[model samples]
Target: MRGRQLRRAEICLLVTVAAVPVAACGSERETVERPTVPRGMDRQADSDADRLAAEKAALDAYAGYLAASRAASGRSDPHAPELSRFLADPLLTRVQMSILQAKEHGAMRTGTLKSDPTVTSVSLDSKPATVEIQDCLDATGYRLVYAKDRRVVPGSGGGRHLATATATRYPDGRWLISSGAAHQDQPC
Candidate 1:
């Protein structure tokens, strides 16, 4: 019995000693070697990434331009000739229609009001762009007067209505206003 017990103790001690050496043999962190990339492959990857980034930037700029056009004042029918000159293609036509509608009938102010965004300046996508716009008119005076039933008649359109516009890059590489939105409460 004593001999057997001594043998078991020796085996445990040997295992513990072997385990200590094995654990100390390797580092806790693994060292990985980076693979070498071919020059042509690297260049191609970089170029593709750059192109993608440029496209993304152009799209973002287009969207922002449209947002501004919708929020800013729109062209006035009183100066229709001058406004029409700047208003080109389908985009301008839509703005004209919106202005006319505002002149004819009042707009609706729905629940959860969100004011339109005004774009300061739109850098055309290298010029020659296509643009589009969509918008809704509001009659509310921004909580100046409360009550849904309380109809606060809007004053005459001052002169120009702020328009939100979105320009998109056409196939020709020109930036055009693809969309626009405006509230024609007051003339501009």
Candidate 2:
């Protein structure tokens, strides 16, 4: 009878030990989930920031070009060295030609050409990154006057003009105006 009781006590001890573990595991609990990030996303974010900076630079260059044009218009020779700083080939040549024509016609601008530019679109994946800008030109107080007779030139009455420019980025990271067009007496 003593041995049987001892055996029964051992069985109870084992059962209690196992049951304790089972009871502990059986309790229900809520699990929390965490957000996971994919690899290389950080690098992509950096690339995007760089692309935006490049686009802004391009837009700035376009604005500089317009400013240069405005300055050149007021000069007797219509040749402003600062104009080349913002322009690249083809467009540079075109601007120079326009300046020369103005000088030959003895025309000089009498007022400021104010430009408010907005970036329309940008593409950074291309070999030469491209940026497009739309500009609202306020020439309401501006006029092109003949140097000799001081008469206002036809179509020189500046009110409002709409202009668009496409700029390109060089390898050295300098953005330059490549092509642009302007419409006189047009709304933005």
Candidate 3:
């Protein structure tokens, strides 16, 4: 019996030694390192993508707004009383008053003619809406053109009579030029 017990203990020791080598062999193999980028670089990429998306959205909105305005003009008169209703504001009112005063001062004719200006294109930024005017003519001593806004000032004629205009939205969901100046650098 003593001989048999000694043989069993030796067998167990041999099995344990063999299993140790197998486990150690697996651990000895090298693990490939993962590639990594700096935290700041990742943040920059995210910021750039966000900025590009915002710019694209703003440009798309401007394009849609211009398209609708052009369609409205084609379907109706540009100088319609309804159209002018959208231009209600202190600035526009002042412009109308100035034009009346100018006409009275002999700079323009007292008699006004009807004009229907066509818009070719329109671009809007944060502060102004730039417009491309077509089919314009002088009527009632006023230049009927596709301008940023109606009511042009003297000595500011050129480039479709580039007038600076501000747009607003009404409670009835209508868009219109709420206010405008003759130019960007100077006011009409």
List the candidates ranked by lDDT, beginning with the highest: 2, 1, 3
* CA lDDT scores, all candidates in order: 0.46, 0.81, 0.44
Please list the residue runs of candidate 2 whose C-alpha ends up more than 4 Å from where it truly belongs after superposition.
1-38
| TM-scores of the candidates in the order shown | 0.31, 0.73, 0.31
Compare the candidates by lDDT and give the number of the best one: 2
4-58: candidate 2 lDDT, tens digit per residue: 9999999999999976864575443312232344779867988889878977798
Which digits, one per residue and each the tens of the lDDT, describe model 3 over residues 1-188?
99999999999999999778766755433322333558799778876674454334433333343343333333333333443544546544564564445444434322232323344444543234333333332233433232333445465343323343444434554445555444323322
Point out the higher-scoring one by TM-score: 1 or 3. Answer: 1
Clash number by candidate, in order = 39, 0, 1
State the weakest 10-residue window (summed lDDT) of model 2.
27-36
* TM-score, ranked from best to worst: 2, 1, 3
TM-score of 3: 0.31
Clashing residue pairs in candidate 2, if any?
A: none
